[model samples]
Target: MTFQWDAIWGALPVLLEGAKLTLWISILGLLGGVVIGLVAGFARAYGGFFSNRLALVFIELIRGTPIMVQVMFIYFALPLMVPVRIDPFGAAVVTIMINSGAYIAEITRGAVLSINRGFREAGLALGLSGRDTLRYVIAPLAFRRMIPALGNQWIVSIKDTSLFIVIGVAELTRQGQEVIAGNFRAMEVWTAVAVIYLIITLALSYTLRRIEGRLKIL
Candidate 1:
């Protein structure tokens, strides 16, 4: 069958709204994930027994589960357990944060550990406190090393946001489904959706490449 430009054009605005929600979810999730990752990474790197065990448990729990299950649990199961109810969008963001956090923690931990032991010794010799050394010396270098991995996580998180459609969040996949339902044009709608996703992913990769280049120069 021929490609249907009209169907795609008609679906654009609806998909745009979904795209915006996806972007918001990804950005907020990435921010939360980075914070959790940094904390977990530090714990694994420097914290004593209790902190190390806790971080290990968290990372394992998140990484071991399917993200779809995590999203479903946050959206469906958590409300039954807690007084606070999160909407689909909030749930999606939270799941992304938790999922990405696990992966990012690994990245951070690896990056920090890969730094030469001499750096830590040098920091101590320079009279820097453990926290100060991590903040000033270790973290900066570790974060630079983490850029490429983090970029990959960001891309994965963005794609994963499509899973939020199960909870009724109007992300691109859900928008495409709606359009297909209305027009009975599944092939056309899905193709358009794929192209949109490709465009967004390419743009994001390009932007991150520029950022990586700048960071390398600094």
Candidate 2:
């Protein structure tokens, strides 16, 4: 079969608009995930019994479940449980945030734990409080070490945005589906979608690698 450049070009504008929504969801989700991960990570690393247990439960719950199931639950079950109503886009974003946060929390915990104990001891000997020591000494080193893992998470989160398609969010994959339905050219439409996703993912990976290299030098 011959390649169809015109078809691909015709789909670009629609895909680009969908890509924007994908980006927005990923960005907001990553932000939310980071906040939750930071708190949960710190709690597991340093907080007392109640906090640690809560974090543990959260991590287990999210990590054990499928992300698709989580998304469906959030979109379908949440409204039944609570008075608030979340639209498809909002539900999808919330799902991404909660799902990604669990993995990120583990990443953060592992990074912090991998830091040398000697640094903590030295900081304590130098009269820094526990919080201050972590803030000034531990967190910096841990964050640097975590860059590679965090980069992996960022890519995962971006791809995970595709799951939002189930909820009727007009993300990249959803747009591709719509285009394919209209033209009845599944091969051309899907190939274009795959290429687009690959391009975005590769670009993100390249940028993250550069950032990781810079962090290593510090």
Number of the predicted model whose lDDT against the real structure is largest: 1
In Å, residue 162's CA in model 2 sits off its true spot by 1.0
lDDT against the true structure, each candidate: 0.91, 0.88
The residue-by-residue lDDT of candidate 2 on 1-218, one tens digit each, is 78787888888899888888988888888889988998899899888999999999999999999989998998889889999889989987898889888988998899889888999999999999989999999999998888888778878887888888888999999999999888777778888888888898899889988998888833
Q: Report clash pairs, candidate 2.
A: none
Model 1's number of clashes is 0
In order of listing, the candidates' clash counts read: 0, 0
Flag regions of model 2 displaced more than 4 Å.
none
Model 2 scores what on Cα lDDT? 0.88
Model 1 lDDT-worst window of ten: 209-218
| Candidate 2, residue 126: lDDT | 100
